[model samples]
Target: MLDVLKPVTSLKLSTKPRGEGAVFKLHYRATFVFIMGCCILVTATQYIGDPIECLPDKDSIPQKVIDTYCYITSTYTLPKYYNMKVGVEVPHWGLGPEMAEDEKVYHNYYIWVPYMLFIQAISFYVPHWIWKAIQTDKVYTILMGLDNRSLDEAEKKDKENLLVKYLALHLHTHNVWAVKYIVCEILNFVNVLVQISITNAFLGGEFTNYGPKVASFLWQDPEDRTDPMYEVFPRVTKCKFWKYGPSGTVQKHDALCVLALNIINEKIYVILWFWLIILSVISALALLYRVLTMVSPSFRARILRQHGGTLRPSPLDPSARDAVDSLVHRCQYGDWYLLHSLGRSMNNLTFLDVLRALDRELNRSHSSDYDLNEKNLLKGKDVTSV
Candidate 1:
């Protein structure tokens, strides 16, 4: 997704001009939100496969699938941390009789779930870090407050110097965003584990096909607790489902088990019904809204914000509305060009506030040349000083 860079003018106008400080706020918010939202979408798809290009994994999460299982299970498990469970402990009502036909199915899902999610989560982590290589200082100059394209290019924005050229067309995202996503993955994975453990405890569901094998292993237990249901984190409440308490004391879970404890047994499903599902659905919708905005020319922003000082207009080009109306009537719709036009202008007018000040300065100047071409013409791109 290469974004064409504008010379930093060509923005839509508002009736009243705003101050430079105001434009700065708009661009800052837009830059921050756009980056965060895009990173979230990109990384979520990494394992699903849209490459931002993966970075070197510092976490040392394994390359081998089986080793990955070993690492998460051994280090990140419920009992190892506080009270966690991995895989489905409950019966698969989602499967019906097909579960009995092949007991190994559950095992397959178990291996893939962590594998895919972890890889997906980490993929974004590295690329996002790389995205920050952009010179945000210069970007701020563009976004500070550009609403009116009335200002001469020299005063409104510095020419596309080295920094802007380097960063403007970047396809990958930022590192901090990658970190945020990996944390999200850790939470999501742990949450799934908590839900499974909780369901197993309260619902007393069988692990379906793995039930016989896992149960047989449990039956060989030294204590009376032989069932996999009994493989619980001790010191935590043992739900009626489990009689086998993870073999006891030294065999107990690690610290995160405490947080996981509050989540398990029927608590997780309860929370899912009460909150997680709804929140997750909202997250999904926000992501979809982002997608639509990228694809549908008709789906313009309901509330666009002004980068320049005008009160009425925001940053969108609604005049182009009719042009995109009929799918067949369209010439090749240039998304990159449009994005550059809107994005760059917005970067300056909203972030820089180029209009009202220019109005003040124009009245103040008594120069030889009448228009912006004069040597003493007012300028405003030095935000670092501002």
Candidate 2:
């Protein structure tokens, strides 16, 4: 939920001082929660119930032949093919195919489906961890210092003023470290793209024989393809099993296997693909917006002026007014620009209002001093004339 406030900074880095340290934004939290839910659903379904359901090929074989094929035996058939030895002969008996004709063989579909989902879930969180590593230490010290209320009154007040100056400088200064945040955003986009490619590559065999078909299907009219063969998540796959007969004679049996889990994979991946697209767009815009903020001082200054004009200042401490004025001068002269610290309370509006109030207080103080001196001089001149 990165809402724009006149584009001073990306919505991810709101200047509002939220009471805790968090490196990830709202959208990141939302996406993470979604992926975690998907992983849990997939894991629970695979372990708690049947991962795949197989139906026998009744049309091609007699009842006696169908009865010879054991469900228990067919279950272990996929793993044997996957773990087959280099020079070992095929088993002397066939387990028989467990699927109908329209269905196809997914090989080890059960294993790969859940495994890919788990990997995707973990990959989604990597960028957040990276951002936390970069941000937490710096943010923790500043926030902890600002929140400490037990220090000596004068010292505490000075520290508070110093904290404000530090934040103002960080916001205004565009440095290498600032670019690190932009890098994190780019990383998030890349991660999504990579994950999509990887997921497609891993699952492509289940849908098509000639490598990944997702690239070609990217714009394919979902409505035009009624055939199950064209489906990205085909429910039925033709399965082939080896039947070894007497004396090293092996008979090959072709049947269909139903991938029950493909139903889940289809729905989850469709949502994920769309979700990644949205996330990529948001991340790219946020990165661009932040980069613009860093390179354009005039842009920052204009935002500062607007903020100063619109916001009302919080109650102020007169002793800290001088320090506040100094920050204002720096920003006014374009030597520095204020940034929103992504803290729930720290924003350009609050900083500008404080500066505006300080200027008003200083002007009143000087005006009173001048009026007192002028009155004293007039009284002395009248007394001399008398």
- Candidate number achieving the greatest lDDT relative to the actual structure: 2
**lDDT string, candidate 2, 1-386, tens digits:** 11211222222433323222132353446676666566556655534445545445444454335333422233332322222232343221123223343322233444556566666666766766676676544544554454444556676556555655555445445444445555776777787667656765775533222223454555567644232222455544444456565677977665544556556666676677767666767766766655675666555544444443443334574433343444444543222321334223344433444454444544665589999999999999999999
| Error of model 1, residue 61, in angstroms | 37
Per-candidate TM equals: 0.26, 0.56
lDDT of the candidates, in the order given: 0.31, 0.50
Off by over 4 Å in 1: 1-279, 301-311, 314-386
Error of 2 at 92 (Å): 30
Best by TM-score: 2
For residues 1-386, write the lDDT of model 1, one tens digit per residue: 21211111222223222111222222223222333333333334323332111111232322243233332342122232222222243221111112223331111122232233233334323322332333233334433334455657765555333223323233233333333333443443344344445434433243222234443664574543233433321112110011124455332211211112211222212322333234334444544544554465444322122212232343385322222232112212232222223343454333223223222232344242455554334444444347
Number of clashes found in candidate 1: 52
